[model samples]
Target: MSHHSKAKQLLQQRDELDEKVKELLLVLETNNSTMDSPLVDAEGYPLNTIDVYAVRHARHDLICLRNDRAQWTEKIVEEMEQDEEKMGESAPIEEKPVHRTSNEPFVKVSSVVELSPADVGGFRKEDLIIQYGNLHHGNFKNMQQVAEITKEYENKTIRVTVIRDHRPVRLEISPKKWSGPGLLGCNIVPIAGANV
Candidate 1:
């Protein structure tokens, strides 16, 4: 199979695995138990409050599934790198100046609070955001979209792409409860004349 096809298949499998992992985590949450939570009481007897068997099974499966997902992610990244190499080999050698007519950065990071989610996620001031979660320049309307995405993906990692030092950098940021006020604790302002 072609690298593109393989990558697509791997992505589908990864997404399926991710859904399964979420389901298992939900099971653990429903039981009011975490992976490290003690299934047995102080006397070494199984706790009557939660189903020890189900929690144990869920935790075990979660570990295995997470490992599998990591493997899939590695394969996907390899396939993507191979695809990029293949494309580069066939492309012309001439380098043309890039014109940011479309897909221009829609927002810029003005400030990032210390020790916040954005700070922990490697966000820096002046980072030009090209993509956040599913919102990109083409579909992005306003800051409200960014707000909605952060709200929707709270406690979950969101893939963000930014231009830092004229290079595209990918970072994973999760919006979650922290010591800070906001979820991200970053100030993002729309770029001027970006048609936001």
Candidate 2:
């Protein structure tokens, strides 16, 4: 019962304080303050009308400054990243070139032998001439102008590169006339760019 009584008393005091505050608000709202000389609170605080507005405006300015600083910091970080990339490009680091096999002009030939009637039908393109019987490559191919290379190049050991069973191989081609019969009576299609 005593606690309840104390609570009631405190509630009544709060009611009185609320009523006084309401009256003060009504007077302030109407701009009616009866004070002499300088208005001061019990705590001796001089109330300046501009103080409230100034404090609020100052807080707004602080927030804008913080936002600007954040933007500036982001810009600075972006610039730094660009600068680092530029520095790396100024003197590019040289890398060791990949070790590679020599690319000689002539294809390598592994085998040399005589040609006969049986082998003439199986010839395809990309055959390398490792051996040219006795005639050199230039002399043999250019026989169109000399006509004697065919005679000199015949019966001589010549080598060629071929692909057999999906593997690269070197074979020999000799001077042999076509003796086997074919299904189609078509004109012979000679290989192109044969250095002839």
Candidate 3:
């Protein structure tokens, strides 16, 4: 297959892996919450052991899949860069749908309110915000920039790049006033030692 086709396939597989990871997380959360008692079905058949074991197995599979996806993503980027070089390009530049490879923790999501834009946009707990629209890299000044941008672009869709469990996931979030308090309804804190 061509590099482009392979990259597309890898991206699709990565997205599927991400969804599986999310589902596994839900399973783990459910199992943990019911640790005091056995999980049961409609007929009250005990399913705690099965549920826990399934979650554990899913977690292991999630790790392997995430690693594979990460490698594929890297290979795709490398292939793209090589293609660009062949076209006389000497430097790698940021393009639309930017995939950040930075390990610099910019912000850590503290909380996400239910039914909010952040929650609706798949912002989960412990997500590391790498970039959001114009808040990428050295563009953002502080953590308050997220709120400022959200309020400024209320009801407009913007790209948000985040790292969850060492994987980069880009999300599009429309800032809007739902039936809640804030526009995005998410609380985030700057990472320690980051130039906030």
Candidate 4:
């Protein structure tokens, strides 16, 4: 396969695997934090023993998936670099900032406060905010742009586009006054300025 196609495939696979890992981690956390062990059954039945083996099995799977994803990501970066080198040799082109593509720019979620609008909206750490309502990719030049856009739509449900685990996800977020430090209760840093 071509370098670009291969890279794209790897990226998609890595993203999917990353998402699965995250979900599995959450499941592990839930299972581990229980006050008392409870049996999980696919159908209603006499309670079966919830064993440590199930959690251990999930943990093992998560580790293997993460390791595979890391290796694939390394391959993708190498392939991308090779493609860039070939393009540069063919013609002179200005190097641009990474993550600031022609597509919608994204912001990385740096922190999220508990019980905040962001938490309610299901925003997670490392989520990439791609669009906020009408704010297109080119419309954002800095982190402040995102804050302003959210403020404008405060108390209203707004459609938000985000890149989570390398996949595009649409979420309806309503930024409003809550018992938190801010309306959204989340901190987002500009991706263009970050190492990622």
Highest-scoring model, lDDT: 1
For model 4, the stretches where C-alpha displacement exceeds 4 angstroms are 1-101, 193-196
**Local distance difference test, each candidate:** 0.80, 0.36, 0.69, 0.67
- Summed over model 3, clashes come to 0
- The C-alpha stretches of model 2 lying farther than 4 A from their native spots are 1-118, 126-149, 162-168, 178-196
The residue-by-residue lDDT of candidate 3 on 1-196, one tens digit each, is 3755765676677777778878877776766732233446678876645565666576677678767766765665555545545565322255344445543557878999988998999998888777777676556568678778788879877777677654567677888978988888888887777621
Leading candidate by TM-score: 3
Clashing pairs in 4: none
Worst 10 residues of 1 by lDDT: 94-103
What are the clashing pairs of model 3?
A: none
**Model 4 Cα lDDT, one tens digit per residue, 64-94:** 9867865775566556656666666432244
Per-residue accuracy of model 2 over 1-196 as CA lDDT, tens digit each: 4444443454455455446545544444444333122345567775665243334444454445445543443343334334444445332244222211211112222322223321542344334332223333333344242224333435542333333332223344444333433221112222234421
lDDT of 4: 0.67
RMSD, each candidate, Å?
A: 15.6, 39.3, 10.8, 13.2
Model 1 alpha-carbon miss at residue 178, Å: 0.8
Local error of candidate 1 at residue 174 (angstroms): 0.5
TM-score per candidate: 0.49, 0.22, 0.52, 0.46
